[model samples]
Target: MAIEWPTTQLEKQSDDPMVILNPKTWSHYHSYGGWGKFFDGLRERKLLATRCSNSDCGEKRLWLPPRCECPDCWHETQWVEAPQTGRIYTWSVVKYPGELFKLPAGTPLISVEIEGVCTKLMSFLKEGTPEIGMAVKAVFNVDNPTNSILDLAWVPA
Candidate 1:
């Protein structure tokens, strides 16, 4: 008896190199672990940051992409509410994004510099044009959360 194989044909896009588009559909289960609180805060319309717990640590600044542990002293970090408003430290217009990008092309990606935060937070600009020193405020998707970093965005303040 002969073994039966899948008969579904893949759509070919290129003829020279024989590039074919393989259709795929599946659910991906992911866990944020310690970073769960950051997403949770987005649901509540709040920006959560992390700081080194050790008082003696020289780096006394908040981390926007909340670090689980201090990179300097390797000490545990604690969650803290970060400033919702910040200035655009830098930005770039993404004309062509990756396959998994949630936003459309031409979206302005920005790095926000919040007060007291040691590092900049990378997020997308939801409205208006982006400038190097433009003031922006955090906007959350509280009504219908995606439970991902997409839930957080920024807009002109």
Candidate 2:
């Protein structure tokens, strides 16, 4: 099913027959260094991260699933394989009905805090209460013919 972000107010239906909808093309920022390499890893059913260049900084960024930019220091990023799991720092259950169908019914979207890192990454919670500080693991799906970063779901570790 097609997904639609709901409009706040009712509107008259369009009568123009020639009206066309332009689908948004998914894109990655190539100008951001090392982003594609991380995407390639996701396509291969793996998770990757970026580590800060300065040893003293020692900050690690996790998720696919992410671009090369440091949300914190905005420094040049170096690639590394992330541990397959972490813990949920915060989460909210998406109980309200919506236009999106790819998401399962009553699903909870989770934001995880990577162990030993001072950052959080978002993913779908698979099972159990998404309490803060609960252990979680990154799981991959490679058997599917079509997959993206969404194919990497998270469950309790």
Candidate 3:
């Protein structure tokens, strides 16, 4: 004899976190005060960095994530445009997306060392398999951008 399952639903809370929230407002905000120039560079399809302008500090390291002060000498920094080309210092492929991130599996995250910059930049790769020490170039999302760091990605040079 075949058995018919009960048509009943349980109205109970489980261990799973609330997957969605509605009737709520969300927005992206940023002062971009110290970093406004950097984002402005992106809008123009250029890469910019900051470096110490102090004369005594022999180190002229270019910082990718521009800083207001030099880490070595604590001197004030100035803006400088960086070349678009660089090499993959190292990278990782995310096989799964995070709860807040909507990326497909196997997406590549890379640390790029620009040609004349001292610091390495963390960015995503657009296509192809990632390899260490491989030359790459920056690709800007000129048409549309969310103003997030996702506006820029890399590709093989």
TM-score winner? 1
Tell me the lDDT of candidate 2. 0.68
Clashing residue pair totals per candidate (backbone < 3 A): 0, 1, 0
The regions of model 1 sitting more than 4 angstroms off are: 1-27
Model 2: residues with Cα > 4 Å off, grouped in runs: 1-34, 54-65, 69-75, 97-101, 145-147
Strongest candidate by lDDT: 1
Pairing residues by index, what is the TM-score of model 3? 0.78
Q: After superposition on all CA atoms, how large is the RMSD of candidate 3? A: 9.2
Write the candidate numbers in order of decreasing lDDT.
Answer: 1, 3, 2
Candidate 2 lDDT over 133-154, as tens digits, reads 8899987766762344566778
**Scored by CA lDDT, what does every candidate get?**
0.93, 0.68, 0.85
TM-score winner between candidates 1 and 3: 1
Candidate 3 clash pair list: none
What's the CA RMSD of model 1 in angstroms?
2.6
Q: Which pairs clash (backbone N, Cα, C closer than 3 Å) in model 1? A: none
Error of 1 at 10 (Å): 8.2
lDDT of 1 by residue, 26-68 (tens): 9878888888999998999989999999988998679989988
**What TM-score would candidate 1 get against the native?**
0.84
**Model 2: how far residue 10 lies from native, Å:** 18
